[model samples]
Target: MGRLAVGGTRDSVGVLCQVLKTGVPSALLTSLSLAQNNLGHLSAMYIGDALAAPALKRLRKLDLHLNRLGDRGVASLAEGISAGGGMPCLDELYLGYNKIGDAGARAVAGCLEGMVVLRELDLASNAIGNEGALAFAMHLSDEGRDEERMSHVRPRLLLETLDLKENRIGDDGACAFRDFLACAGEHESGMGGGRTEEEKIGLYCPKLLNIFLDQNRAIRARGRNALQVLHTTRGIRCMEGADW
Candidate 1:
């Protein structure tokens, strides 16, 4: 819905800030595409906050691939999400080719606790390794079990898709994700697909429909087989090939 592609060496952040200051209300903007733009470090955070402030109340999609925003910038965006100050209606976020590391991933997971409508997240080509994946998995597991954590976000705000292509997650992280998905599927089935408290929540929540793990060199043949096993047992689809 919010599509913006401000290419070249222009002062994108300054322009965006000016736009927000002018109070044009970018609430209807969605499906933003800012690829190939040389927005400096932490520039995307400024752009994200500005765009999400007034115009993202109904925004649903964002594309910020190939930017220089490091973990600090991602953390700033996470804080915005946590405060519900931006992108309240966001469902999809693209953050490829950034420098988001473990700390950044942790911040993102924390922010996700507030994103009740988010369905898909793309974190490709970041420096997120196994530690980062583990941190994210831990948050997912905690959010699955804690009703208090689920208060801010809707119970149905399950992430149906996730793209983590070209990251450095290893077999350990893959196994953790596999186990989480399996646990979530079983828990959902046990709850009779009900949203009420009468049905006990499982160790993992939110059934993912698709996962993209392409170009993960750490995911060897054995790891891939392990993920396949997890998919078969959990009923979640895994798209691991490079083409995916």
Candidate 2:
């Protein structure tokens, strides 16, 4: 199949899951959307398992927004992805309005470690705070202190868009994003030497073109100013609030 968009079909998701479980094959499906389905954590768990299956490994885009998947649900999804070693070609993931908190955000960061080709991730209108934002920054900006560790865990530099609007992020989270930008700049300019051009072209999220941090009422002037510097220097689009 091509694009299986069963969004807003709250009552039929169970049947969809059954079809996903029994039918489909690898590289056949490209996109799947189940947004606004009133899905809970259990449903998210099943979808995550489906993502890991060989049938859905080639899926490029997945939409699960406007649901009730809380922290537990998101964590279960992450665990399913990690365990199954699936969704290797997934590019975009939408999970906005899921009521996810810090723990769920951390699980997502861990899950992102394996999605090497993923380019966009949407977590808007959730409950992510500084802890969760910091986790994302750490994974996005980590350049590996040693070769052994680097060989085992690689940073997710392919991410281009990150949507974290309407969350609980404050100054600390904003500052972490600033640091991520700095790391990306350094990698882009080849300041961190000894790596090949292919590896260094866009390390530390060099391709991150847009970032959304608006409506985070906790972000103060300091954090806003910090990001402002990068916006001017790094030439990346940032939307923090009216202050910016």
Candidate 3:
């Protein structure tokens, strides 16, 4: 029911493994921090397995910053969380300062599609390019494509904040975001399905309240128009460059 911070401990992974092995009610644990531990793919796999325990149901916040979890590790962890049948309560996830790239980001987007309650996701400094950003933008903002309507259907995210600073998001990715935001706003305004505001928020994403895309210089150079379009939208807040 409280926070657990054990960064810099050489045996932090061991501690978590012990807890998992002992069948502790990690469900009651709200936060887990394993920052600056030099943890790699192996440690991530162990953590992945631990998170599968049903007893870890109440875990809402997870910090895995400053580690060496490569794309495989990232994919493994995402798979575990998706299949664990108990990460539904997770609201915040920190994967910053890792060397994650497009492949890992795509995997994450695919795996976490069912986690409707996730609110804040941080992927700063991950070297994620346009492909990765587009994957996330498309994944989080869409439920499915409707062949009949020739458009996207709905979104499953209640996400309020997202961080993508210092990555490689480019013009194409920015266009995806522009389209996503426009569609999201249209849906949120009670124009789609005749749903109420609360229903819109609970069903399709209401459009995020805040997003951090600062320091992705490529967007500035090539996607300024799309960024401007995004900036002009009312209600939501988007951060880019030195602002926000």
Candidate 4:
């Protein structure tokens, strides 16, 4: 549909309460950019709580940039998103210029595990460092394990696209991420239930295509080579820098 940007100090909490209470759905199904709106951590929490309205589920893109949502605020927002649910259809999420450190990134990583359909996520300029990146990588590894266990009895999950730009990830964090991707790719390819080689390869080929890991400064030559190995083995293309 269209987009919705609510600003001005008209008591954001009150507005959110009204929106949730009245259930007035916006008629747009596109993006929701709330950047440069001076939303502090508390305001962001309130706004996130207000977004529980079912109407917000129609949004495909969401931007909450320059809001100064610190670690606590980011955790609150992620919790709110999980509680609100209906984010299965969400494609892109932007949370740049906040103060989300490692704790905040861990919270986001937790939320991401639940969003099986999410494609793109942005966490740039948020004071996220190697610890944050490592936390996220650990989350992916855990997710891969969970997927493996599930595939033994049920259907598998598909998750693609992730962005961690300008987060100052170090070499160790980069290596961890690359390792997780490689292992996940292998597991996904191998979990075809004893299918033919061609069938297994087909199932594995396109799954990694949807993953995007761009803008990790600590990604050195070895890390890049590891990613290349994953690409060659799994036939997945991981984008870097502004390629996304």
Candidate 5:
């Protein structure tokens, strides 16, 4: 399936829903790309409902890029993913484009509250501003600020690659991410029920290695300077604006 492009179609999501209802466990269905489809909010809900099918248990990769699934559709999708036990095994999510703004980003953030399975995520060019970027950063960090307070539970992601190449993550947003990385770098794990130091740095979700922030035009040397904190640790790569 080379770049499964099925845009401008409203019925495909219906067909997908029907297939999902067939009760055939989609253990082999690892990737599905319905990007560029103006699969609007209503159609997106159909997709969301389909995702709730038990047959689609093993489904992982989902690409809704360039679709018109605005905040409402995204929220619907998030709700479906969370209900009835949720797709806990999902690893990669591509929600680039599709006119997702900060509100939608917030919904996505809410969806990831306790999730820690995702490894690669791309929220590129979704009109995400500082608030949205900050939301994503909150989840992406290796660890939270207060892990000692809640040592009994595991939180956050194992994200390795993240892309926020466009939209509006200005200086403030840039600083937020920089500080988050700094905190992760300095984080030390406790020997109690807490996760290992690497996991805590990433909130028990380490292995974040690459980040792309190209063409935002707002991040300059000042923001880049703040990013130096990440360099203090090894195995991390970043590309900001034209410097990449």
Candidate 6:
């Protein structure tokens, strides 16, 4: 099967893990959904190891949302995915509503540094605060800087959609993304030239089109306005729902 969807009991997931380990039957699987299963951290570890299995090398999209894989589980999954050159072809990942906090967010960011083919990431409806949010913003900013310096060798992230809604992110966390996407402080450094608009913006995920930061009540007027400016004047779309 090229796609698999499981509501996922622990026993069923365990069996799937065994199949993945053997690298059979799921060789053609490109998408897998285990959403809303309440599969806690232990399941995450098993799934992570299964992801590294050679048979599932073609997998691209993974949906683990609402599995309750808290900080410890996320860290374990990150480690498993990063180790042994796992999930090389995978792209989209959904880890929302798993009780992830700052440390888990940071671990996920670290894992992402290696997944250059990654596109969309959904971390919404979790416990991410300023520290977690800043981790993401800074990671993207750092990647952009690296791309600017080594345009030829470095692989740029193709991330387009980042959903961080219903979290604890405050203005400081929200504005960090503003600076990263808008290249707020970089222009003042005088990196200007005959470069294109995207190049002028420091090559930091220039393809990023939308970011969802709504429902984060910690964001005040200043942060909200700043993101709105990005959506209006700049090319990025900051908020989605009509409630904003």
Best by TM-score: 6
Instruction: TM-score each candidate.
Output: 0.78, 0.84, 0.81, 0.74, 0.80, 0.85
Off by over 4 Å in 2: 7-15, 23-27, 143-149, 153-156, 183-193, 196-201, 240-244
Higher-lDDT candidate of 5 and 6: 6
Candidate models: Cα lDDT each: 0.65, 0.76, 0.71, 0.63, 0.68, 0.78
Model 5 quality (TM-score): 0.80
Which stretches of model 1 miss by more than 4 angstroms? 8-10, 143-154, 185-207, 242-244
Cα error, candidate 2, residue 170 (Å): 0.5
Error of 2 at 243 (Å): 11
lDDT of 2 by residue, 1-244 (tens): 7788876443466566656766554347788888887788878877776665666767799898988999988987787666666468879999999999999999998777667788999999999999998888767765322355565545455788889999999998888877775545464453345666655545556687767888888989987876786576555566844433
- Candidate 5 versus truth, CA RMSD in Å, comes to 3.8
Q: What does the lDDT read for residue 32 in candidate 2?
A: 87
Q: What is candidate 6's lDDT per residue for 1-244, written digit by digit as tens?
A: 8888988688889888898778677887889999999999989888877866677767899999999999998998888777776567788999999999999998887777556678889999999998888788767755334445545444567788889999999998878777765654464245445656555554546577777888999999888877876665446776787433
Candidate closest to the true structure, highest lDDT: 6
Off by over 4 Å in 5: 1-8, 25-27, 113-115, 142-152, 185-203, 240-244
Model 3 Cα displacement at 67 (Å)?
0.5
Task: Order candidates by lDDT, high to low.
Answer: 6, 2, 3, 5, 1, 4
- Cα RMSD (Å) per model? 4.1, 3.6, 4.3, 4.2, 3.8, 3.3
Candidate 4 minimal-lDDT segment of 10 residues: 199-208
Candidate 5 lDDT over 118-184, as tens digits, reads: 7777888877888887776665553333465355554556678778888777777777776666565
Model 4 agreement with the true structure over 1-244: per-residue lDDT tens digits: 3766656552764565456435455534456777777677877776667555666666677788788888887887788677665466667788888878888998887776445566667787777777787676656553334655555542222445556666666666666666665565454554445666554444321243533446666767776676666576666565554332
Worst 10 residues of 6 by lDDT: 143-152
Report the lDDT of model 4 for residue 103.
Answer: 89
The Cα error of candidate 5 at residue 45, in Å, is 1.2
